[model samples]
Target: MSDRAPQPVERQLPTEEARDLLALVRELAQREIAPTAAGEEDAGHFPREVFALLSRSGLLGLVYDEEYGGGDQPYEVYLQVLEELASARLTVGLGVSVHTLACHALAAFGTKEQRAEYLPAMLGGGLLGAYCLSEPSSGSDAASLRTRAVRDGDDWVITGTKAWITHGGIADFYTVLARTGGEGARGITAFLVPGDAPGLSAAAPEHKMGMKGSPTAQVHFDGVRVPDTRRLGEEGQGFAVALSALDSGRLGIAACATGVAQAALDEALSYTAGRQQFGRPIADFQGLRFMIADMATQIEAGRALYLAAARLRDAGKPFSKEAAMAKLFCTDSAMRVTTDAVQLLGGYGYTADFPVERFMREAKVLQIVEGTNQIQRMVVARHLAGPESR
Candidate 1:
């Protein structure tokens, strides 16, 4: 096989403004987040302070419209910003992505009144938002969710349990998908359920393997009443809306995966260059050099995939298949890079003294969440098979 691999055609060279934003993100991430990530992860803590800092810096609303105190930037730029934040701390990166995904219902399909009421609090206040789609039994098969929303006069009474919800307890609002009609995906409907709605309560957070700093909980909505005005999109259109939102959300996850891989590769490069093996640095070994080469190559390819999908989104083109492909490639790459990084450090890599073990742990969750790699393959295959398969 040729040593030169196929060049990914999806590279997104950031603009000057994007570079400036990256500089700001890097500064904040290294100075503020890096110091606390380990401690918070060990204690199973959430960094509310980071949200405040991001809000004040206008980083939270980088992709939203300017009218709502947002930057209205392109997805390629926004995703790079997300990557930089995630490289420092996955919790903040995921929190930001979930918030952005939550805004999709309002931004793309909401009524003017709904957007006016909610978009500001989301983009301007850095008030976190959680997407309530996955149920206890319905994970990758999200359309089959059992959550129910019954119409009651001027309000809708929601009763269901949303599982694996990031920011479930801490979010200011939730973009909930519930069954309002009959069965299957078509029966689902979306709503903007305020976090403080009566009868809405969150269960104790789950004990996760990684991203521990970002709380995941089961939110129970027992007869939670929401104004009819809070309904997102038309009834029965919720599944489509949720799918569309997830297509973009998958891109965010892809960026996160790439960041994790990049971080792992960086750590491995630094370690191998300094740690001596047989009177020379480990990097001097040809075998380790080849491994590093593979890691760098995979990370670059993953970046290209995500950026291509992001550009498609920015251009308002069909990008669902591309998003799935990116998510699959990037997350898989992250898992491999982090694993190899740990192996490179030998025993030290397995210990807490180095962050490679943490990166390895963190990379795994990226592959499991946001429609798992298997689901992503199904999505891509369906897309490739044309409308007949779907």
Candidate 2:
């Protein structure tokens, strides 16, 4: 890895305020985040303190309401901020996104009382969160989840296992989905489950290909009780809430994909410029130069696509289709760009000695998470040609 951090993308932020925010985020990414990313990742250490610092800096809640301790920035500003953080480290960037996704059920659909009670701490109290929707058998078919939440007066007892959860064991709280009515999508309900709730236990984190610093575990809820006051939306409305949150979550993943690609491109450029091959620099070769150019172009275009979707969301317009497209295009671009980056570096790229290889590993997960690229295409296809024939 280079001793220096990657340069920030020259962002066209909407306001002077937004510009200042980006500058601060970039500075933090370079100083506090990037400097230790490789070592921490290698050690499989989760930098929870860095997330605390971000919460204190007000970066954790950039897209939520200021009344609830958030930055109240638009999605455009938030996504750009995410891109910068991701450029430094994907774990932190995607961690922030998953936190936002966990908070979304209450922020967007919770009763006003629920919002007033939980939003502040979740936004800036250094309290991390996890979202639980994917289960052992319900990855793509989220509606078919089998977790059960049975009503018992004012309390509901939840029992089932949720898999592939980020922040699974470490989160302060969880936004959980369970079946409260019957089978399928219409049967689900959303609840805010405290992390330390009785009977809530998380399996050891999975040994993953990348983002090892970010925990992915399976949480078991064995008769975990949740109060009625903690229910996020109404009974049988959890599926809608989960889908709504995912549309925005997909945009976050898109921004993260661009960030990783941007980082890979920067590393490739840095290496080629300094590495001598034919008595000069490898960058001097026309073929290599063309590869670099193509990588840069894809990164730029992916950024644009995600930002466009974000703007549509901010404008209160229907943006699900655009969000899915952005997610598909940007993640695929990240996979391609990162692979090209490795090719550009020759043998050095294949080793853990450089960040490009790490970027390549990290990019693979983005295509699979936040609705896999295959899933993103299905979503876009649904928008285009309606649902697939049963």
Candidate 3:
């Protein structure tokens, strides 16, 4: 063997291969997701069929391990696919992302036995997972969650409620964080509680301003039983696992934000190019042209930030701060971009006739979920100021 280090294959894909995948994803989004998205939102219907289609296409496991029947693709590629999906239907895109977050604990920290027992159904399209982190009393201050998991011989008896659980009523499983130690962050631990466990129930779906098709509810766990084997990692590891999952999950939200922005820009561009005003195309006006330019520029910047953060994570680098930054920046940018996109559409944008208003509604949740933008700021500040700063 030569003394020199072996050459590493390029992590980045060839341009042609990337383009082909993008084209395929875009086609799927347009052909499958776009057609029913408006009606689904209007009727408050979940597009269960769209998720089945995605599962059939292997998009659900895009960033998972190949051994588990995942696509084993890079996060960079996966995020781009998410962008396309959200551009068509944000509800589906976000639901997919949330499902992945709920599944993250088993994938990252599960024992080999646990992995073998659970990974297949989760990786396959047969099961969907929901992350349970937030509570009615504990939104940003997750460490103070009041949910309790008491050891009861071979099984743990969990009692308390998990609020704002995405897919709470519909998911096959829930990854719950509850107190197992004393109080505060150190006291928390994670458990893989099946959705059908006895004493587990979900409240009626929340009526939200946007992403109406996606369900959100409070999950009550009254003496829900989980085997000791279902405990994820060691006791008191819940906080770490939740934070780790959030770092990755934030990137997913950022990607969704980028997609929302891109969709708005594409719509604005198409409408302005042909929809005439002053007896000519309004796109020709310098003011309107400048607005479009700003939209495109901001979208590109946000995309770059999130992609860079994803790359860091895939490479096993410390990515928490970067992920928070990307999440905060991209979601904020999305709120601005989608609002501007509606403005570009003039009266039509404000009405249900165009998709811009819908996009705006969908964009708002991205900032609030995963971790609120305020929480994201706190996370970033902690990283910058060190442990001593108040």
Q: Estimate, for each residue in 1-390, the C-alpha lDDT of model 1 and write its tens digit.
A: 112322222335567777777777778888898778888888888998899889878888888889887887899998988888888889988889998998898888998887888888788786888999999999988878999999999999999899999999888899999999998988999999888889999999998878888999999999999988999999999999998899989999999888778778777877887888699888889999999999999989889889999999989899999999999999999999999999998899999888889999999999988999998998898888855432
Q: Per-residue alpha-carbon lDDT of model 3 for 1-390, expressed as tens digits?
A: 112321211224435766667778888888889888888898999887788777777778778887886778778888888888898899988888988898889888888899888877787756888999999999998999999999999999999999998898888899999999998999999999888999999999999999999999999998999999999988999999998899999999999999898888878887787777789988889998999899888888898899899889889899999999999999999999999999988998999988899999989999998899998998899899866443
lDDT of the structure predicted as candidate 2: 0.94
**Which candidate wins on lDDT?**
2
Candidate 2 per-residue lDDT, tens place, 1-390, comes to 334445657887899999998898898899999999999999999999999999999988988999999888999999999999999999999999999999999999988888989999999999999999999999999999999999999999999999999999999999999999988899999999999999999999999999989999999999999899999888999999999999999999999999999999989988888888769888899999999999999999999999999999999999999999999999999999999999999998999999888999999999999898989998899999998887
Q: Can you rank all candidates by lDDT, best first?
A: 2, 1, 3
Q: What range of 10 consecutive residues in model 1 has the weakest lDDT sum?
A: 1-10
lDDT of model 1 at residue 231?
Answer: 93
Residue 220 deviation, candidate 2, in Å?
0.5
Clashing pairs in 2: none
- Per-model lDDT: 0.88, 0.94, 0.87
The candidate 3 region of ten consecutive residues with least summed lDDT is 1-10
Model 2, C-alpha of 247: deviation from truth (Å): 0.3
Which regions of candidate 2 deviate over 4 angstroms? 1-6
